[model samples]
Target: MIKRIYPQIQGEIESGEDVLEEYSRDWSIFKINPSAVAFPKNSSDICTLVNWASLENKNGHRVSLTGRSAGTDMTGGPLNESLIVSFSRYTNKIISIGDKEATVQPGCYFRDFDKATLRKNLIYPAYPASRDLCALGGIVNNNSAGEKTLKYGKADKWVKSLRVVLSDGNEYEFRGFSGKDLEAVMARGDLFGRVHREIFRICTENKELLEKAKPKTTKNSAGYALWDVWDGRTLNLSKLIIGAQGTLGLVTEATLGLIIPPKHSRLAVIFMSDMKEIAKVVDICMKFKPESLESYDDSTLKVAMRYAPEMLSVIGAKNIVKLAYDFMPEIWRVIRHGMPKIVLLCEVAGEDEEEIKSDLDRLKANLSGEGFEVRLAATEEEAKKYWAIRRHSFALLTRHAGERKTAPFIDDVAVPYENLYQYLPALEETLKPYRKFFVYTVAGHVGDGNFHIIPLANLSDPKVRALIPRICEEVYRLTVEHGGTITAEHNDGLIRTPFLNIQYLPEVINLFEEVKRLFDPLSIFNPGKKVHGDIAYAMSHIK
Candidate 1:
C-alpha cells in the first residue's frame, strides 16, 4: 500500500511490526505513535505521498500531512499517527541567493546555512534556543526566535518565500515582499498578495470580529497572526505563516533575509539592589540600543558559579564610582550601593572597541551618579564567561535541584515597562500560596518588555495542574492589564492551550478556529493541539 501510494519514492516505510520507538514521539510534550511512517528520499516522493494521502480520504482515513524538521518540535506535531512526511534525506540544492535572500530545503540547519553563506559575511538573526538541534522547517513552523531577537526580530520577518505543501496535494509557495512587487508590476496578483487581498476584504467585511481580535501587544506568537492580518490593508503573508504552529500547512522550504555580522559587542553586568530596580535599568538600557540586553537572576548566577567559575567575569562596566560615602571601603560601598538582587546583563555592539567603550563610559557616568557597581565584560572570552550563566542556567538549575526530576517549562509572560514594578510583589504572593514549591529565576529581553519566569515546581503532584495556572493567570492577567503578550517567543503548544482565552478575546479564538478549519478541515493534522480540546486523551495517554 505504501509503495502504491508513493511509487516514485525509493525509501523505507516503517509499518506494523517494523515500526519502532523513533515513530512514537517528538522531542517533548505529548507523544503518539503513527499508524505508519513514510521516509521520503526526495521532494517528488513527498509530492506523491501527499497526493496519495489526499486520495486516502476516499477510504475514510483522514489526510493529515505534517513535516518532521529533525523531529525536534516540542508541540507533539511530529508524533501524529497520520501521513508523517519525514524529510531527512531530501536536503539538497542551494537554489540561489538574490539580494541577500537565499532559499533552501526544510532539512537545512541555520548553522549549516551560516557556513554556506560565510563569504558574504551574512547572518540569519532569528536564531532559536534549540538552533543546534532544530531544523529550518521546525524553526519556521514555530516561527522561532531567541536571545538575538532583541536586535533582529523573529524568523517570520526574515522569510522571503515559503514552499508549502497544502493538504490537497497542490504545491503553493507563499513568497513575501519581492513577489508582491513583481505581481504589481505584472498586473496579476501574486500568490501571497492575492490571498491577502481576499483575506483583507473578508476581514473588512468582518470588521466587528477583527476589532475584538486585535492583541494586547505588538509581538505575539499566540495562535494565528490575527493582529498582523493587514499592513494598511495590504496583508502580510509572513504573519500568517509565523505562529500557526504547523496546523496551517506543511512548510517544505523557505527563503530567508540576511544581515551583516556586527564588528564587535561589549557585554556588561550592572548589579541591582533588588528586583524592583531592574525595570528602571531595563528602561535606561533601551536608550543605548545594544546588540543584546538580558538578565540572569540569583538562581541562574549562583547555579552557574557552582558549576562554572568562569561566570564571575560577565561584568563589563568601565567605571564604578562611589558617589555618597567617603567613610566605607570601595568594595563595600560599591557592593552596598547597588547590590543587585537581580542582575542586568547588557551589551553594546559597534564598529570597534573604542565605540563600545565610549558608550559604556557615558552610560556609566549617567548611571554611576545613581549608584551602581557597573561591571563589564571586556573580551570575547570574558563575554562567553559571563554568558555561561545564562546559556547553562537551565542545566545548572536542573542539576542543583537534584532528585526532584524536573523539566524546564520555559514560560514567557510579559507586560509594558510601566507594570514591571507590579510583577515582583505579585509573583512573590502567588508562589506564597504553593507550599514547598520554589521560584527559580525571572529574567529576559526586558528592553523589549518580555520576561521569562522559570518557576521550579514538581509536575507529578496533582496540585501543580491547579497551582501553576493560578500563578500563570496572575502573571498573564498582569500581562494583559499592562498591554503585553502571554507568550513572547515560544509558540502556543499543548502546554499553553488553556490560557489562550485569558490573553485573547472571544473573536480571536473564533478566528483561530476559522484558520484551523481553512487549513485542516478534516481536523487530523496534529488534532487537539493549538486548540483547546481533550488534553488528557491527546497528551497524557499517547506517550
Candidate 2:
C-alpha cells in the first residue's frame, strides 16, 4: 500500500523491522512496533499521505497515522500500531521571525526556536522539562508548560496561528476569528467552513459550562482545550488545536506568539524543614510574582547531589567559587552542612535591575518569619545550578534507579495552589502500601501546585505492575477531591485517557468526541488516545 502511494509523496517511506523499530516506542513505558514509518518532507507531502491513509485499502482497513516529534513523549502519545509520520527529521525549520511572533514548522526543536527568538530579543516562553529535546509540534500538541507557567502561561497562550491538515487531505490555516472572519466562516460551504461553524456552535453553546470546568490550577493540558477558544468575543480556533495531541489533525506549521526578553533576572533558593513551611514559602514567592517557582524535596536534592558534579561540569563553572567547588573536595562539607529537607527555587525578572531587587527584598521580608534560609544566586551560574536541580531532577532519579526505571504514570498531577499542603501528604500516604516495591521521589513547579512522583518500580515484576492502576486511582481521587487536574501540563495520551471522564462532565466528553469526529471522521490520526480510550489498552502495552 505504501508502495502504491510512494509516487505521490516527495519524501521517504519504508517498512520492515529496521524502519519499524525506530518508531516503535518513545520515552514512556509503552512500546508497540508501528507497521511502517513515513518521513514527509513538507506539508504537501503530508497532505498526500494523509489522503492516502484515509482511503480504504484491499483489506478494507484504512491505515492510521500518528505525527511524531522527538518521540520523547512520556504518555504514549507517540506509541501506536500505525503509520508513524516522523516530523522532526525533515520538517524542522524556522520559516520566519517577526517583531512579536515567529512562524515555524512543527518539527523545529523548542531550544532551536528559543535560540532563534533570543537572537531577535524575543522569547517563546513555555519551557517544559524536555525543552532541549522536545519539538514544537509535541509541545503544542501536549500544550506543555514548565516552570514559567505561572507567568508566561502554556503553549496555548503562545500559539498565534496554525497550518493544519485534516485526515481527508483538506488544509486550513487556523487563527483567531474576527467578527468579519467569523461571518465569512459561517457563510462558506466547504469542509473547512463546516468545521469552523460546528466548532463555533459548540464553543458558543457550551460557553458557561466550559468556563466553569476550567481548572483553578496555573496550567492544564488534558482532553481538548475547548474552553480556550471562545473569549467572550471572537473565537480563537487555534487554541482548540494547541493541546489536542495530534488526534485532531496534523499541525504542519505554527506561528507562535513571542515576548520581549527580560533585561534582568534573579533566582533565589529558599530552604524549609517540611511541607508546611515549603507551602508558606510558595505563598510568599507567589506574592512576588516570580517568573517561576519550583520545589524539590530532601530526597530529590540528595539524589540530585549524586549527579550534581557531572551536571555542573556540563553547565560549566564560570567563576572562581564554582571552579574551586569543582576542583576542591572540601567544598562539599560546607555545602552539605546546611542543606534543608525541602527547597523552593524562584526567579524574578524584568527589564529593570532595581525593580527586580526590590521585589526580591520584599520576598525576603515576607519570608523572614518562616525560619527559612534564603540564598540568592549571586551569579548567573549559581542561578543555573538552582534551576538545574528542578530541571534535571527527574533525569537524576532515572539515572540513579540502577535496575528500575522511573514510571511517570502519576507524575504530573496538579491540585489547586491552596490545597498543596493537603494534597502532598495525602498523596504520600496513598502510595504507602506500595512503598516497599517502588522508590518514588517528588519534585515540581510548586507555584502552580503541580508535582511529579518519580516512582522507580521494576515494571517486569507482575506484582509491581498490578499496583499501577491502584496507585493511579488513589492519586487521581485525591487530585479531584482537591479541585485539581489529572494532568496539569502534559496532555492526556494513553496514560490519562481513561481518567479524562473522571475530570470532565459527560457532556464535555461527548463534545470532545464530536469535535474529534468533526475533524477526523476516519479516526486515523493517532487513534486510541485522549477522549475515546480505556486505561486497560494503555496498561496492557506497558513495556
The whole-model C-alpha lDDT of candidate 1 against the native structure comes to 0.64
Candidate 2 residue spans exceeding 4 A from truth: 1-7, 57-59, 316-339
lDDT of 2 by residue, 172-263 (tens): 88988878878898788887788888988898899888897888777888888788777767777788888888998999999888888788
lDDT of candidates 1 onward, in order: 0.64, 0.81
lDDT of 1 by residue, 1-543 (tens): 443454345765666544546766664434566666667766666667666665666668565656676776644656565666666656544666555878878777666777777667777888765555667777777777777777888887888778776656555766543355634633544433345555555566777666665655435677777556565534556568766676766676788888877888887677776777767777677778876777767665556645553223323323212211211332364466533466677888878878788888777766677776576665565566556566556545645665343333336666666667776666666657664774567667666666666766555556664455466567677667777777777666666666678777876777678767666566645565567544445435323
Residue 22 displacement in candidate 2 (angstroms): 2.6
TM-score of 2: 0.94
TM-score of each: 0.84, 0.94
Tell me the deviation in Å of residue 483 in model 1: 2.0
